[model samples]
Target chain A: MNITDLDTPTLAADLDVLERNIDGMAQHCQQLGIPLRVHTKTHKVPEIAKLQIDAGSQGITCQKLGEAEVMVDADVDDILIPYNIVGKPKLKRLTALVQRARITVALDSEETAIGISQQAIADGCVVPVIVELDTGSGRCGVQSPQAAQRLAQQIMKMQGIDFQGIMTYPSNVRAKPFIEETLNLLSSDGIPVNIISGGGTGSEAASKEIGCTETRSGSYVYEGMTRVGNSEMLTPERCVLRVIVTVVSTPTPERIIIDGGMKTFTSYPPTPYGHIIEHPDAKIYGMSVEHGHVDVSECSHRFKVGEQLSVIPLHQGMTSNLHDKLVGIRGDQVETTWQIAGRGKVF
Target chain B: MNITDLDTPTLAADLDVLERNIDGMAQHCQQLGIPLRVHTKTHKVPEIAKLQIDAGSQGITCQKLGEAEVMVDADVDDILIPYNIVGKPKLKRLTALVQRARITVALDSEETAIGISQQAIADGCVVPVIVELDTGSGRCGVQSPQAAQRLAQQIMKMQGIDFQGIMTYPSNVRAKPFIEETLNLLSSDGIPVNIISGGGTGSEAASKEIGCTETRSGSYVYEGMTRVGNSEMLTPERCVLRVIVTVVSTPTPERIIIDGGMKTFTSYPPTPYGHIIEHPDAKIYGMSVEHGHVDVSECSHRFKVGEQLSVIPLHQGMTSNLHDKLVGIRGDQVETTWQIAGRGKVF
Candidate 1:
């Protein structure tokens, strides 16, 4: 089926743009001599993760255990989850995942480390553990080098756990001194830091300079408005994903309503939830659960009922998570349909 | 199974509160002498729709054909879709639905009316059509009473299509004059208005006073923070839905990270994305794809790793759409797990 043949309010990825985005990031990482670990959280499709692995990505990174399980089913062998896995139910699932693939988890607290260690012992497996440092993204991680050292020591003492390395998200140039200090402290303790994972699409180019061995960037695969606005490397032309919506009503001359809304797109802050590809002048100012209210007063073009429009989401990661499948398109033709295996795998 | 047995970042509905909510709305509509037509968009589970119908709802209202299809499988005979149905594929599905059940569609444009009429003719069926009036929501509908009369006239002229009545969402007291004017115009034109649906939980109490025969309230079944903040009928205690998330990390005394985030809950505007049921003072200020950054500095309770906290979302409709299934709980025990049959049917 072609674009018109598919139902409205569906997500479609341009294959040509997707390949270019994949190749562009791969080449950049290759030039920097840093192993690229593509985060599968953005696309959530196993086929896209496999494609990334084929295009020179070292492995895949998932934020949740349920997502890693999906990747394992797709024959992905190496998976690094850069989030603290707590609770017996989740740890048991993590241990099962460790049996099928090389699983590495990041933790900042001793309580989390102890839980993983217990689960690993029960499963008779040694799980590699990474100490997450709060080099800057103040979301989750140890505050200082001394804290990282302490966590690393705790992991080393555990029976079925090994201290792998250190990792941080949204790694920037400002984090260089902190990362260096942490590595020095680990080195002084004679701790073998095999992996120093860092980077998000926002700070990917500076990851290697900040001493990150591998860059884990998810949005680079399906560049959204946020990435395109921040990075010189990305453009709207390279945006692979688009929410194809139909103009269901134009109630007034200024106000237009589309079939897609917050349920179909991301509800992330910053007005204009998405950018209209064909009608750039038309602003998507408001949204309800199922209707996107667009202000098209300045636009010279007129929209009619049943007319379709392509929109690039402000946040691609959350938008992709809202859908079950991604319709892959090449030029004007339909290429393939890939199931978003980890769509609601928030656990 | 219990709440602890399930993984973190899952949605759970309190069965007792759910039953209370259903009975409360049913009683309110009954007292007002208005037929209640509960919208299924809030909780897309067929079981919940069945419960609403059993609780005295005349029929069900859905925004999309995909959702209506799921309700049809659950043996719902009357379905009113309050959105303009466009495109050949969607019309084909709507026509098939018309064959099985009584299907009514809301339209403001003649093009949409003609489309549905032609599809109904092809399928040898008559589809009831309602002219949506722009009373106050200003989202989708005709502006003036004359426009509504014109659309009704067009519908009356079309073959295999019957002009049923009028409807508006989030109807308020200010819309009373508009509804009266539209009704007067239709009466003057010799049009029989069978149904006058005006709704949303925010204005359900005022619907009858505003001259509405029926009220379509969705979020009333599972009240969220928005509803609780708006009406006295809803309270945090009355809210049936809660996102049970685990405290993954407490990086600092002030900052606590949960397993739920933008992917699990919503990142919509207005300070906190959700309200913590256990810790009312804790503020959910920020979120990444998989991490909910909450500030618990003011709270006296200390959260430990693996501790589950129930969160009342800002909007129940969007939060319900994010989950694949709703874990129905009574006290601490999971009573049932209902599949959200229309979860990702955004088409």
Candidate 2:
């Protein structure tokens, strides 16, 4: 299929750019002597995961059990789920995952660990469990190292569970100090930390400076306008997701409406709807399900109704999940289409 | 499949409540003696559209050509596109749609009218075009009466198009005044107005006061959090769409993590990630792609890992597009499951 033949308001991945992004990030980690565990939550396609693995990634990291299921289905041997897995259905799934490959999950509470242990015992498999420490996102994970040690101690006492290491996704600029404090507290109690994992696309450099065994970054593989707005290293072409929006209504001298809105392009960090690829002066002011409000008041040429514009989303990770398939384009030419195999893998 | 058996995270609708909502809206419009043109953009399912049509909606309104295609595929007869259609490919699709049903499209520009005229001429069909007048959403449509008259004049002169009537969405308190002014302007030019369309769920009472011939509202069939938040009459059970999320992690004494994120619920209008159904005290602090941040600090009971929470999203229209299927529930019983056939129909 040609690029133009793709369904309007769809996600298009530049395979060549995606490969460069994967190889570049993997090479950076290799040069730094740190392992790279790329997160699969961004592009849930199995083919993309294969490319990342081929680029020398130590393994793939999944934030959810469903994502891990996809990575495992893709035949990626090593999988690390940096999320606390709970619920009988998910635990049963996780324990079953252990039979096929190396399976490790994050634990932030004793209650969570007990459930994992029971599921592991029932499945007749011992699973490695890591402790998720809340460095700064302040959203999840255990708060203090004391809490970590307490949780880890509880997990160590479990029969079918192995306490592996400590993990934390530190908030921006606090990686070094937070890691040091947590390390001192855990090691002081004589608890060994084997797989200290932390970091994302934004904090990758700071994460490496903290001396963690591995770093996890997802969006770096498909840099977006939001990431590029913050980081200077990302190139626009490296962005794997693009929304092809058609101009629906040009109401005034200043505004043009596009068919792609919040449904097609997700509004995260609440940034402008999207970055207009061809028109630099056009800015997305607001959006609804089927209409995008573009303020092109400053642009010289007017975008007539029915015109299609490719937009790089402010956030790429969540946008791809909005669709079912991704058209893999290699420089204005579509190579093939990949089903977002694990789309809506929120569980 | 039973709604409970669907294995989804948040299934909140009571079948009884949904029926009441649908009936209530239809009855309200029936009592007022105004033709109801329910917008199908919210519930893109053809079954719901059929129900609305069966219950006495004058016709159905679609926001995108893709959605109209789905509705036409389901054999829906009368369809109104409440958006400006432009471009050759889109115009061709609109022209092709003429063979299936009676298609009435909104027009706001002479350029677009000319384009559609050419396509309709080539297709050997006379297209019914409604001039969309900007009442106040400030989003689309012609602002002044003069601009609407000029566009209507062009439509009358076009080879394969007929200026049927005028349309406007209620964005301000003066919608009636704007519609009246546009009608007066067109009549001054000796143009006949047949279908004067306006109104939504929010502006139904106001719409009747404005006295348009038809009113289009989609959210009334399936109430959402946004409508519930603003409406004095609706309840959570009346809401037809919800994101079923599982507690992935309980990070702190205060916060509980759920597996539904922006992908499951669109964060338009920037409300807290989601509203907990039974737990009103819980505020969704933040969200990642597949995880939700629930602030449970004020709650007495700790949310055990793996527990399911039903989160009511702010916008129901966009949330309906996030999933492929919807299961209608009556208490704990699954009544029916409908495919969101219009999911991602953003072309």
Candidate 3:
């Protein structure tokens, strides 16, 4: 059945804008001689990843092992896992992933590195490992370049592990200065920074400016509110991804309700996520499951009760995780629909 | 894999607490002689719904069609869709569900009632629907008794639709008075109100005291902070769900981070979501993707990196939505592992 004809509220993508977004990011990175390793966690679909790779993404970056499995199954080669794979189940999964394709996993501590090393040795496989360096987004990674080198030295001594790179996800513009300082520290310490993988859609350009070889720009391919704010170069991201909703009730002239809420679009606070494409003035006030309350009080008397609206969400990455399928469209025409392969894959 | 033995920072559930919580709610409703229709939207697993029914719930209520589908697949006899289901696809799905079991849907507006009526007519099915009256909670439902009556009249006239009942989700004790007054209006109009479904975990006793025939309480089955504040009768709610997480980093001497964040827990704000079972003073300040930062900056240095702590979440319903599997344990011993059958079910 056609998505527009379906009886549910959804986020529909505009293809013309989406192609421009994908091609625009690739052209910018190619002009700067940086390999675009689009993060699969954003779209989390192999088709979109394939489109990015076909457009010149050197490879794909996965945040979870389950996501990596999706990318591998989609037949996309070169995968970079930027998460510290903790425990035996994940290690076994990571080691097996290395056997199928060229997999590079991140590590910030000797304990996790030792675990990864042990798994690689047991599998009789040489898995490439990168020491995650903390630049700014102080979520994970070693604090200093000295720590990175120390971890790398330990990995070099360990059997069946290749210390291939130094990676860091910086806090936006700090990608340039922070990475430069770290690169200088590593070189001075006689540590080889072969991969130098750092950069998200927010900091992709800055990382390239500072001599990083690869940039992971996942949201750019689909173009969420964050990516739209970060990249002024890309045309307003229009892809086939949108939340399609029909107005169910108008309790008052100001308060109209739609059948899409927090369940459809996870939490993107301060600004009620997903822009109403049909009604520019209509702002989504709050959402519960099966209902999105739009404060059309400003545009009161303008909205009809049964009108359907398409929304551009504030955060596209997490919203994609909420659904099982994406109805890919070309312009106003429905082209294809793909299951969000490996969706809800918490493991 | 054994949940406790697993290496990753995980969210472990306590079965001992779960069973006690189930029995507590069942007994509370039984004492009042009110039908306990547990909202499966909180748990989303059919196994839990079955357990709730087995514990003495009259039926199960689902927020979405997808959730209802999961329950129906698990052979849940009676299901209530508390939200207005729109669109041709969803309506068709709802019609198909009637063949399997008893289904009652909620409707707030005449337009939605018409849409459902049209779909039900097309499928040659007479679906029972309840007019959602707004007692409080300012979300979905008809505001005034006059509006409720008009909608009821429209529903009665609509083809292939039966206006069997009137329902409301009351926000507080004020709802008791408000709903009782409204039901009087409906009865005076000679409207047959078979099921006067009102009350949530927040207004359970007031719902019964105010004369609602059926009270829908979901969170009380696995009670959390929201229900705990509203209903004092549920004490063992603390025992059902526990988020088990491992400390990943100690960024500073004062701040410690756990490896479960927005991915493991829904980012519903207000306060730190859960109480750290191991650490009393520690409060979850905020969370990124893989790290939940706990601030213990003021007092002691009790917890180091890699320590495991189980947290009792402030909101158990949404917390259950984030995980793929439910690890049911009885006094640290896992009894059964059930798939979150309706995990990302956004229909």
Candidate 4:
């Protein structure tokens, strides 16, 4: 099927570009001697996860049990959830996930581990636990290396828990001291760290430099390199996904309203919400609830009603969370339509 | 059936608040002697549209054919798609929609009208068309009152098209001149204007004052009055829906990470993404891709891991678009769970 035949305000993934992105990330991680564990949060498609694994990724990482459940159903093995599995409901799902596949979780607090440990004991499964360090990210994880050491020690004593290693987001220089201190502390206690997993799209080498055994990169699978503050490696064409939208109304000589809006593309990374592939000069200055207001005043290109624009959204992860399907297209011809299976799997 | 039993980071709509909001909007429009055409884009639930209709809404407004189709399937009789139904795919769906329900559309250009008229002719149906006026929105609409008159005249001459009236968003005092001038221009040509549709959540009085025969409101059904900059009519408890999230990690004394993040809520209306209800003094300072980073230093209440929080998202519509289900609850008991059938229906 042709992409033009599909409905407007749809997601179109350039298959060739997608393949390149997946291969490039895998190769980059491999060259660094760190196995690539692709983060499936960006695309959330089971097929794409399999594609990353096929491209030589060691495993896949999911933030939610619901996402992991979808990946497991599709036979995409070796899933790790880098999140504190808190509450009884998530613990129940986490324990169930351990029975199906090799499920590992990341946590900062002993309360989170205890909840999982109890649920794992009841479900009769050993869930691998990773101590998440703050590393100056200040989002989630223990504030200090001593706190990380304490959580790891507690997890080791728990019956249905296996202490994996340490994990932090966007593995950077700030994480160096904490990770090294935690390693020394754990080694002195005779505890082996199997995985010092660090995450980032353009920071895989940094993760390796910081003594990471494996690196988890998500955005790299779909032109996420630029988003991670590394512009030299990323080109516009490398952006695998483009939101296909049509000019629904050329209201004025200066303004053109597209079929897509905040519902289609997210509002983050602020305005110039999307990069219009057809008209490079057009600026998406504002957005209504359901209409993308494009300022075409500066552009020499003439926009007309019914004309289509392939827009590469500023923030792909936020955009991916809004859509249900991702179309794999080679030029105008569509090869496959995959449901964003992990969409709305926030729970 | 208790909300505490339900999974964290899920949408919870207070049934009592939702019903009150429904009744409140219906009463406000009725007191002003203008019919209410509720916009279902905020909730995207068939049942809520039905509830609005039951509470004296004349019809419902959908932004897309997909949303209109969902409402039509749920037996929502009158649906006004306040968008230019451009291209073949949408026009085909639009024509099919006219057969199932009383469908009306708003457009600012002849090209958009021609496409709809052609499809309507082939389908042997009369599709209602409303000439959208700019009225200073600078989004999608004809530039001036004169452009609106031209489009109305063109619609009157088109085959299988019914010229409904003029339409503008966020109806205010500024729309008065454009609406009145357009009404006079159309009257001079002996063309009767039936429905002068104005839209906004808090401006029903303004809509009526601007010669609007009817008004369309979407956000009011979900505590959207405050979002429209009218805080007098809205209360904190009146916010019908709240995103239920759990504190996954209280990483520091100041920072706590909630299970829900951008995927669960939205990034718009800027900082303090969500109004933390449980701890009023607490603030949602930042967000990771999948975790809400909250600053709780100012709060007297001490947060713990596994603690639940009911957060009122700043912009309800953006948050509503990302979810698949809208779980209705009365106090703590689960009342109903409705699929956001019109979600991802931007096409």
Candidate 5:
């Protein structure tokens, strides 16, 4: 099948670029002596997870248990969920999941720790937990190194839960002091720090510099923006996935409408919705629920109603969740189709 | 099952409020002497479409052929696709779809008309087409009243195509003069204009006042905001659909983290991500991919981990596309679960 011959508003990923990104990140991590835990939240496809592991990723990280369940069903081993698992319903599911694979979770509060510890003990399974520290990003974590050490101490005393190292998101310089102080406190008490996980799109080198044993990187698989020792940058050529949309209506000389909209693209990165591969001069000025308003007044190209344009969505992770399957294309030919099975698994 | 017992970050619609909204819109349209064609984009559930049809809707409107196919497979009868159908792949699907049920498509260009007409002719099907006028929306439409007549004349000359009347989104005061002038011009050419369809969430009364025979409304089933002769208004009690989420972490006294975030909710109305029912004084200040940053600085009540809250998304239609099922609830008990079967059908 040819790429251009498919239906409009279709999600097509460049297989060449995908391989390049996978190989690039795996090599970068291997050289830095830090294991890369490919975060499955970006592509949400188990096939991509296999590719990352084949490229030497140590393991995979999931944002929720629902996604981890999908991966476990696919025979992928070693999963890490970096969010607090709260409530009885999730606890029951967590107990069932730990029986199937190597499961690890994160915690920032004693209440979260108690819930998981009780569930793990009752299910006759041991669960590994990492203390989450705030560093600087004030989303979900303990405030200071002392607070993290306290949480780690409580987790260590639990019978069924093993206290791993620590993890924080978007590894930055602020995490350096906090992680170093907490590591000193834990080691002095004779506690093992097996895993120190940290990562983001442009913060891989920082994750290694801040003393992380593993980095959970998700966006690097598709959008291809990495700042690990200048390994990769945010370039159009680095982006693997492209949304193929056709020109549906030309309301005026200054405006044209594509079939993809807020449902296909996203409002993340706020301005300049997408990067049009065919017409870089064309500005995607606005978007409705089902319409992509494009500004082509400055472009010399005269777009027809049936002509197709490829758009690389600014935020590929959010956009991947909107579609069911992704078409893998190699040079104008369709190679494979991967179902985004982990989408909408927010449970 | 009780609503509180369900998993965290579940999409639930209040059955009583859903019925109140459905009945209110049906009664309002009954008094106005206009047929109501429910737009299925808001809910994208076949059961909700059936409810709207049972409540005196003439038919339903789908934004894309993919959604129209889902409705057709579920035995939905009349569907109006108020967008142009271009490209051969979509044209083939549209031909097969028109064979199953009554499918009406809208067109604003001669190229789009020729493409659909050719495919319909090859498949031996008569496709109903409506002339899309601008009406100040600046999205997808013919520029002026004269341009509408010219497109209608061209469409009338095409084979395997029936020229239905006209349809415009967001029926406003600006649509009055354009629709009236086009009606005169189209009628003088001895062309019968049978359907004058115009609609939006808060523009149904304007649709009737501007001489529309039927209005397409979809948000009334869930969000419950309408302006059909003051039939309803935007209020907390009016919103039928509520996204039930749980507080996973309280990082600070002033801040709490909900499990729902950009992937669960959306960045659509741009400010105040969601209206928290439990914490009325609380503000949803920010959103990450899997965490909703909530500001409870002004709230008198204290929040705890594992506590649940109800949130009505500002843009329910966009948020509806993010989930797979809509749980129907009556007070505290779960009534039914409807698959969002028509979601992500943006073909």
Candidate 6:
């Protein structure tokens, strides 16, 4: 099937562009001598994760254990879950996943480490875990170097647990000194740090400078509009993922409605959920549950009903979670269809 | 199964509250002498749609043909789709849906009417369509009464098409005059306007005053935080849908991270994505893909790791679409698990 034959408000991935993005980031990380650990949270498709692994990624990183389970089912053996697995139910699932694959989790607190240790001991397996440092994102992770050392020390002392260094997201330039100091403190304490994984697509190029032995970049495979606007390496042309939407109504000269809306795209931040690839001037000012309201007063081009428009999502990861499958395209033809196996596996 | 046994960051529906909410709205519409057609977009489960139908809804309303298809498979014969179906592919699907169920579509433009008419003509079936009026929602529909009349005239003149009056969303107080004027204009033109359907959960009580024959309210079945905040009939206690999230980290005195975030909750509008049932002062200020960053400085309750929090989403429809199933709870026990059959069928 061709691009025009598919129904409206569906996600399409440009295979040519996707391959280029994958190879480009992989080669860049290889050249920098920083092992790339592609994050599966962005695409959530096992095929894409396998492609990333084959393209020279050291391992895959999943934000949730449910996602890690999906990757394991897809034959991906090495996975890192960079989030705390709380509660017995989740840790039980995490233990099963660890039994199937070489899984490592990131914990920021002693309580979480103890919980994982208890589950791992019951399962008769040693689960490797990394300390998540706050660095700068201010989301999750240990705030200070002392806290990191304390957490690492707790993990090392716990039975059925292996402390495997530290990791941070967005490995910003500001995190360098803190990571170095933490490494020095650990070294002084006679603790071996195997993995110092730090990276986001935004900071992948500077991962080495940020003292990261391995980098984890997810959005690099399917460059979103935000990345396109922020990253010097990414352009709109390089964005592999696009939501193909059709103009359903032009209620007024200024207002136009598309088939895709908040349900189709992520409603998160930076006004206008997506960028219209065909009309740069038209701004998607608002969105309802099923309607994307675009203001086309500035655009000279007139939009007729039934006309299809490709939109690059502002955040590709969140947008991909809303879709069931990704239509892989190569030169206006659908090359393959990959199911988003981990789409709603938020647990 | 029980609520506590389920994994974290999952959607749960309080069955008692759900039944009460469904019956309350149905009885309210019955008392108002307005036919209640529950929109299935809120909780896209066919089982819940069936429950709404059994609770006295005249029919079910779907936003897309794909959703209608799911409803049809579940044996819902009467369905109304309140959106313009453009393009041949979607039209083909709509025609197939029309064969199995009594389907009505909404249109505001001649281009869309012609496309539906041509498809209906090819199928040798007369498809009923309603002219959608703007009425101040500013999302979809004709801007003025004249535009609504023109679209009605075009649909009336078309072959294999039945003009089924008009409909508008959020049946605002200001839309009363426009709806009455459009109905008068159509009646004066000797066109029989059978159904003047107008309603959303926000405007369901006022639907009769707004001159609506039938009211369509989706979120009433599982009222969201927005509806609970706006509607006098709804309270937070009546909201059936709650996202069960676990507190994964307490990074600082003020900041706490939950297992749910933008992936689990709707990021649209009104700040804080959800309301914590136990702690009203704790605000979910920001969210990443899988982590909800909450500020709990004001709350006196201490949150330990693995503590479960039930959050009522600001927008339940968007949040429901992110999950595969809704854990139906009846007094802390999971009585049933209903698959969200129409979850990602956005096409």
Which scores greater on lDDT, model 2 or model 6? 6
B1-347 in candidate 5: lDDT tens per residue?
Answer: 98989998999998898888999999998888878999999999999999989999999999999999999999998999999999999999999999999999999999999999999999999899999999998999999989999999999999999998998988987789999999999989988999999988667889889999899988777773222222123345788878899899998999999999989987664557777877777878898888999999999899999999998777788889999999999988999999999889999
**Which ten-residue region of model 4 chain B has the weakest summed lDDT?**
B225-234
Stretches > 4 Å off in candidate 1 = A230-235, B230-235
Q: Provide the lDDT at A41 for model 2.
A: 84
Which residue segments of model 2 deviate by more than 4 Å? A1-7, A171-193, A230-240, A269-271, B1-8, B121-126, B159-162, B171-173, B184-191, B228-238, B269-272
Once all C-alphas are superposed, what RMSD does model 4 give against the true structure? Answer: 1.9
lDDT of each: 0.88, 0.78, 0.75, 0.86, 0.88, 0.88
Ranking by TM-score: 4, 1, 5, 6, 3, 2
Cα lDDT tens digits, model 6, B24-133, are 98888888888899999989999999989999999999998889999999999899999999998999888888888899999989999999999999998888999888
Docking class of 1: medium
- Lowest lDDT 10-mer window, candidate 1 chain A? A227-236
Q: Which window of ten consecutive residues has the lowest lDDT sum in model 5 chain A?
A: A224-233
Runs in model 3 deviating more than 4 A are A1-3, A171-191, A229-240, A300-306, B7-11, B171-173, B176-184, B228-239, B248-257, B271-273, B295-307
In candidate 1, what are the lDDT values of residues B55-141, reduced to their tens digit? 999999998889999999989988899999999889999989998998898998998999999998999989888989988788999
Worst-scoring 10-residue span by lDDT in model 1 chain B? B227-236
Q: In angstroms, how far off is A242's CA in candidate 1? A: 1.0
Task: Write candidate 4's Cα lDDT for A213-291 as tens digits.
Answer: 8898998777743374443333457788789999999987889999888888887755677778777788888887789
- lDDT by residue (A62-105, candidate 6, tens digit) is 98889899989989999989999999888888888888889999
Q: Which runs in model 6 stand beyond 4 Å of their true positions? A: A230-235, B230-235
What lDDT tens digits, residue by residue, belong to model 3 across residues A1-347? 45567555655566677678888989998887888888887778888888888898889898777888888987988999887776667778888988999899887877777778888889998878887877777567777766766777788789978888878785255555656776676677676768988677767677777677787777776776665563222223454367878777777777888878877887657565667766767888888755788898778446655676787776776777777778766655677778888565555
Which has the higher DockQ value, candidate number 1 or candidate number 2? 1
TM-score of chain B of each: 0.95, 0.92, 0.90, 0.95, 0.95, 0.93
Structure candidate 1, residue pairs in collision:
none
